[model samples]
Target: MRDSSSSSSKPVLTIGLCFLVALLEGLDLQATGIAAPHMAKAFALTPAMLGWVFSAGLLGLLPGAFIGGWLADRLGRKNILIVAVLLFGGFSLGTALADSYATLLVARLMTGLGLGAALPILIALASEAAPEQLRSTAVSITYCGVPLGGAIASIIGMAPLGEDWRVVFYVGGIAPIVIALVLVVWLKESQAFRAQTGEKIAGQGMLAQLFGPGHASRTLLLWVACFFTLTVLYMLLNWLPSLLIGQGFSRPQAGMVQILFNLGGAAGSFLTGRMMDKGHARRAVFIAYIGMLAALAGLGLSTSFAFMLVAGFVAGYCAIGGQLVLYALAPTLYSTQVRATGVGASVAIGRLGSMAGPLAAGQILAAGTGVGGLLLAASPGLVVAAVAARALLARRNRQPQ
Candidate 1:
């Protein structure tokens, strides 16, 4: 009876813990946008400088994802995740305490590293914990925490905190430190990782494993899809509120839109995962990309608050939903031996796009481009992402399950 209960509860526990960490990550990611107006005033930053502020953390994520994922394969996922949580949590506090622009950038960079490292492991842990048939749903469930966390940050931003932007970072930093402690006490190492033989553990070089015969094409396609998909998604995430504010909306009103966006993202993430698990992977992919295109157009064209609200929700639904689909699909592309590494590398490459999105948006906006033009400009990339994603899925379908 004890054995039966333990077996039944293990997956739930793992998924639940991962969900908490993902929630913290989401909060930290969104906190920047939520605090941007105040941060700019506090630090006397320009739009281009603000863009660099956003990208600084993302830059950290690139290396963090690569190195963290690589090490998690050798070290246990639980161990690496704990350290990542602490690293991000601590620096998030640093972000709150930063007195100068340079200090703020360093804090965000370090925080991004932690956030980047934690994500691939979370995906891997959730994927490994669930039954094969339910892997997508499990990952989606874990990922839902992200937008939900973002929603929480939006709520905080809306509060009358006297424009104390540091409040967001303080909350973002402290919670993860607490969660890391809980994880240490309760989180278990991934069962799949423990089951590998010594020979497999000592297997091929990283380059060979990722780029070897059957993997090269899939890896490149995944990178392409991830890069473009994240480019659009992160742009929306880091800039949507600012864009809305730029168009003469009040900060509170923009915060409300941000909240709705995140709530919509949570719903989209959950539903897409369910659809993928029910053998509707193709349909899910189609809806994700097509919906994203329409949402971008809607966001670009909308003038009224009501229309903007609708557009925000749809953008969250499609953009974030599509990202969840990618996260769910990535783990299935490689063997367990290199699963974290593969997922991390894909995430790292995607971070490059994520980094580019904000910086490009900042520069474009600085160059006097309107929100409409900037958003419309992102359309071509989505088309490219859709094509690559479809091709990757088709290739995966042809392989043996």
Candidate 2:
């Protein structure tokens, strides 16, 4: 009974709401990273222990992705999204209050569970709400919250905010509470989803579909893409400031460069997501990955600060934009029956990279591989991602487009 035009426009409003939610989600995702140094000092943590605090959330994410996807399929995306917001918001507050490292780590991991579920549900709902013609744009805009949140956290957390790094967590946690309330009131359930999976045919759900024959390979491929992308991306974000400082920049200069790195990601998300709508999600991703490689190489090889900034900008742009646009591609490749599962699997797999990237980078640093060598080591993932992207695109294009 809904008018077609109205239906199309409604999705935009939903996208906007979800976009804000996505922003909060992104902030929560990186909130720990931004506050890590201060938190470490407060807890008297060792470097290795501090590293665990940073990655603790990711541990929660692995199960979170699977459960979130499954829950979305069973209970509906709206229900799970609302719950995720509440979950993340509460954890953010809890994280802020923790006086001990153990408590803080638990809070982060709990927050990660909310984040894991939140992402796939948001991407799925946004993509499903949009008319097929506008699908990529919708997904990308929602996803844009990732970098936008990252940038905001990086910028805001830099403030002195008195002694406690916990203030960052408090702020990060509370923002989502307001957003979740808004979503509960304003956001609409995805009609496309209702139509696609209406009244449940008895047999289909998350598990059955993921393990089904037609879906397993595509699901695995997306996972590989996420794993490598996250591994490299997190390593870059976590280490870039030190790397820059070691390259002869002052502390403030290194910090400024890190901000630029995140800003570039925001720009790339906007560009790559919109471009994906024009068709060739794979090809666009391929180009982004190639750019990521080139950017990292330039950043590593160049001596000038100006050049390093440009390289960092490009690397941040392509690395994040290319990697995340693949999430948008998820809904397209699978029917609603398997959408959440497929997306969840991909994200859950990628969480492995999130855990591994920093750990691996730390090892390389310990072994005395300089920043240049580290950057160089990370370049191959992009290359592999580029090839994977092309194959995925060619496969997708061959379908009845």
Candidate 3:
């Protein structure tokens, strides 16, 4: 009975810890956008420079995901996750203290490294902690913290902090360190990882692990799906408010939309995961991508505040929710041996898309592309993502499950 009780609590403890870290990550991820105007004013940054500022953290994520995953597979998930939390938390503080553009970029880049590293580990831990039948639900529950955290950041940004953008970073940074301590006391290493034999745990080289035997096709497909999906998601996350303001919406109205978007994302993340777990993987994919495309069109064409709010919520629902679906799918594709490595690589590739999205949006808008044109251009990518994700699910279904 004691063993049963402890076993039952493992998933709860694991998912709870992962969720806290994810929450802090979400806060930091959106912090820049919330504080962008103040950051721009304080440092006298141009639009181009602000784009780089957004990309800097994403740039860190690319390598961080790869290296963090590689190491997690060999070392252990909980240890690496704790280190990642500390790294990001410390750098978040650095972000608050940065006095120059160069310093700000460096701080954000370091913060990205920690954030990037923490994500794959979180996914792996949550997926491993839950029963196989409930894997998607577990991961989605952990992932919901991200959008919810972003909503919190939006609220902080709206507060009368007197435009002291540093406060946002300070909050984002300090909370993770506290969580890290809690994790140190409570988090457990993945039982699956512990159960693996030494030889299997030390599996083939990185290239072989990813491209080994039947993995190449799925790996490529997952990358394609993640890349395009994140491109749309991050573009909206970093640029949505500015886009709304460009279209004549007030700042407060834009902020409200942002909050609703994240709230919708939290709901979508949970629902989509539950849907996939209920043997509706294909249906979930269809709904997520189709909803994304339609939401984009709505955001582009809607003229009223009410309509735009609905559009933002739908966009968040589909885009951020779609991302959770991809994440949940990633772990099932690889064995416990290389799970983190494979997931990390997929995440790293997706980070490239994330980095590109914000920069591309900036350039496109600078080139006189209106909000509608910019949103419309994303349609093709979502279509590609939809096709790749569906194909991957079809392939998974063909396996001897």
Regions of model 3 farther than 4 Å from truth = 200-206
Ranking by lDDT: 1, 3, 2
Winner of 1 and 2 under lDDT: 1
Best by TM-score: 1
Better-scoring candidate (lDDT), 1 or 3: 1
All candidates: TM-score: 0.98, 0.91, 0.97
Residue-level lDDT tens digits of model 2 in 219-280: 66667778888888877766665566667876556556666777888788777877887765
Model 1 per-residue lDDT tens digits across residues 191-211: 998886363544456677688
Give the RMSD in angstroms, all C-alphas superposed, for model 1.
1.2
Worst 10 residues of 3 by lDDT: 197-206
Candidate 2: pairs in clash: none
lDDT, candidates in the order shown: 0.91, 0.77, 0.89
Better of 1 and 2 by TM-score: 1
Off by over 4 Å in 1: 200-205
